[model samples]
Target: MKEYIERVTDGEDLSLSEARTASSLVFEAATEAQIGALLSALRAKGETEAEIAGFAQGMRDAARTIDPDRRPLVDTCGTGGDGHDTINVSTTSAFVVAGAGVPVAKHGNYSVSSSS
Candidate 1:
């Protein structure tokens, strides 16, 4: 974890393996503060595609999904870094789009910092 933090401090991007390892630590972390710092650091540096993929994969591996007997699925998403006191525009847009005969499975997260 310290090594990961150091690499971010030096303005270096994480490789796929590094991203996976660091993200896996998020679930096994002993404290919440460490998880916050890890995410903040990655967001501050602007996650690369490979890094994002690896991190997402790690989360996916940790999650359990059920195969529901439903129609085919369509998913759309966005990671919000919008300013304070604002609603999620992407989710709203998804609603509108889905209402117009499109399927949308939208997801969001909390983003407290990033605006300069």
Candidate 2:
């Protein structure tokens, strides 16, 4: 949909030419029907560990331009899907560590199902 494309591309700081290239790539790769089917299948099956690992590796590669040496950094992330009803213990731990003068990068999604 046009609205979906607009929302995805708006204010992304990309050049016009770059945006056009990306749009072309998306359009050429998958039709709306194909996209819908792929999404449905992925949602039903869930992502495999290899798929997740590839995604994470891609993210790390994309961050190569960033200088990690600028700060003494540490990341605190928890595996396992906590239902978000546990009072955000990990977030609290991040704050405590930060308060104790350790730089922490905490990554978490909002809730398992939005209302949880």
Candidate with maximal lDDT:
1
**C-alpha local distance difference test of each model:** 0.73, 0.51
| Model 1 TM-score relative to the real fold | 0.54
Clashes of 1: 0
Clashing pairs in 2: none
Model 2, range 32-76, lDDT digits (tens) per residue? 765464434434555445434543553444442533575866677
User: What tens-digit string does per-residue lDDT give for candidate 1 at 56-107?
Assistant: 9888877656344444545666555655646666766888887888656666
Which ranges of candidate 1 are over 4 A from the true structure?
A: 67-116
